[model samples]
Target chain A: MAERVRVRSMMPPGHVRTPAYLRGKVGEIERSLGAFPNPEELAYRQKATARPLYRVRFTMAEVWGAEAENPDDTLDAEIFAHWLIPLDD
Target chain B: MPHDHHDHDDFHHDGMSPSGHPYRADNDTPLTYWQVMEIAIRELLIDKGIATASEIAVQIDTMDARSPADGASVVARAWTDPDFKGRLLQDASAAARELGFDIGALRLIAVENTADIHNVVVCTLCSCYPRNLLGLPPDWYKTRAYRSRVVKEPRRVLAEFGLTLPLSTRVRVHDSTADMRYIVLPARPAGTESLSEEQLAALVTRDSMIGTGLPKSPA
Candidate 1:
């Protein structure tokens, strides 16, 4: 079964992979892109630990609300595992 | 006063100032602060013996040698060969290697445009492009407007580029990252079955590969 997830609303001050617009939004995991070094830590020249990266899919409506021209259109973004929360439904 | 006017005459028309130093036009030739930082870092790295200047020059030369033509050839081959398309869709980096493109550590993903779905790629954080296959990205790809708005309004963005898709067609925007890059394999245009691979490649534009526009029909 496909996993449904929501982007965390946390806003930390440094390099981050999650875009601000996507914060607190819901999306589905398309696929696992395997583990990659955490770029957030890498930016500070710190040793980066590998984290699972997943490609998340979101409908235009989910992102832009009623302003979307095509609600059915989808956008995919690669988000690190640490940035996503698995939903209970 | 005559000597001062004579000194002005001594200034070369080819961007040299009256002081006999090379001068860059304020409007046309100033490097951005980021560019200046890049130069400083590169020189510092070389001075520290971390990397040689010649190695940097060779890397730049290799990047300069790549163009849209390389990507066009890949698309053309995919259009003509079903097996090759399968491989390309399954493992883009490997398939690109088969065509002699040495994509570095970053994974390359090939998204196909179909009758029902069209794909577009963007890098919201930074401009992460498939330079190994398509050379440097256009300036517009690195703009703030494009990075912020393309995912939100892909159809409208495509329209601004003179590419209007039917309402029934779905637009999928792929956000690229430092770890992965994406390229769109545009659908083959109609009435080009008789054309050779070389001729078909000529129809593929850089924008089409980027998914902002479509390939031109044969004229």
Candidate 2:
């Protein structure tokens, strides 16, 4: 079963794949996309540690609150496991 | 037109000097700052024996040879073959390879656009596109407005592209990253049953595959 997770709101001052808007927001894991070399470290040409990547799905309302044009809409982002915290139902 | 140098000098003598103006910017240099930097980096890399010029040329040729036709053919094949469509939705990279397109190290995912669901792709950090199949991404895909707004307000963004989906349809936006890329397998348009594989491929526009628009109806 896919797990629910929340994006960690870590404001590191370097290259990152997690968009700012998704930080600290709750989302559900849609799928496991296998493991990949950490891109955050790869951007610096350093040896990248492989990390599990997940496809996370967030509702439009969860991301944009009342400003969302459609509450039923959803967004999926490829986020590394290091940036996510498992959420309990 | 012969013997007009003196006449040209006289014409410019009213406000400007006969000699070139000292304040004039040098417009003869064809390379922009970024292009100059790119050349410098390429030369440095070559000098360091990291990559050869021939290798660079081959990479350029490979990128130049790719176009929307590759993606169109894949979509067309999927539309005609149910098993292939299953393979595509299950493993897009391998499915693309069946058509002679290797999507490199990055994983490729194909999201289906159906009557109840619509999918759109974006890359918020950078323009990580499926260039092997779709060629270069359009300029708009790289803009900040698109990278930021598409994930937040996809319905409005699609509407801006003249696609007003039914309110009942759910819009799902996919944000591609360095390790993963996405392409939309748009629903086959109505009245396209009579079209051949090649004709169906012709109907698959790059934007449609990107999920910003739908395929044109058969004429």
Candidate 3:
């Protein structure tokens, strides 16, 4: 089988399952809860079971742009552990 | 070597459950006798020991708990705190946690609505709903017409729902695909300034959170 997809800090930049609206975006990691199976793997029924999941928070204007009324307010989302890679150059 | 059988037997596209009914399709389809038999076969697996009812029930329970009073608490905190509201607008899942709710395994996105812009969520593939936060998706949400037309012709679709935003109000459509889901946090309606959290939660109906209605005066 494929080598276990490493828990890397480098995230791929492109039209990934990660929302088109959220790519190239910066957000804080509110907390890191451990592994859960990646959705792509689960959907396709890949071998690995649980992988990690994280809750990343972003502002409304950050995602929606100037159209946001209360530009000061923010919104956060729970992303799977595998879905995110740490920010490293 | 004669290849072994890989179990494609259980795999199904999102458009239809294994039984061949469009999993979320609202329009009627006349089933042929053969197709009907195939559906019966698929359902029997569900009915028999192949898949337990408890598994489905577990999925339902997970969905229910994800959106329950925890949802109310998230909205309530937003009403009371500016800094937290700022965080919520920045990152919805984190915001949800601020109110002491853990989303667990489910993924969520908070779509914000404003004076000039309104937001709506649809799953073009299937009813990939925020089952946890919004309760069950309304029937119309799963319809083929709503899914196909919402993105291309939003104003017409909104009008069908008895929602006619000002021509000036820009409507943005968020299409949910696969695991990720969208939830709309509508602007608190005017004249609700003094309402208590319980009263405010009452005004914040599922439809309002989904962008089909606005937070309104208590009936």
Q: What are the per-residue Cα lDDT tens digits for candidate 2 across B14-41?
A: 5455565534555887899999999999
* lDDT winner between candidates 2 and 3: 2
Candidate 3, residue B63: the lDDT equals 68
Candidate 3 lDDT, tens digit per residue, B1-219? 323333333434345554666555555888889999977876786888786667767776866666534555566567767787778776777677656664654567676788887887777667877665556777888998987666546667778777887767767666664456777877877877788877777767676676666666665
CAPRI verdict (incorrect, acceptable, medium, high) for model 2:
medium
Instruction: Choose 1 or 2, whichever is better by lDDT.
Output: 1
Which residue pairs clash in candidate 2?
Answer: none
Which candidate leads the pack in DockQ? 2
Interface RMSD of each: 1.2, 1.1, 7.2
lDDT per residue as tens, model 3, A1-89: 11112123345553334454455556656555456556655666667467556546555456557765444344444455555556543
Cα shift from native, residue A11, model 1 (Å) = 0.8
Per-candidate RMSD vs. true structure? 5.5, 6.0, 14.3
Q: What's the TM-score of each model vs. the native?
A: 0.88, 0.88, 0.55
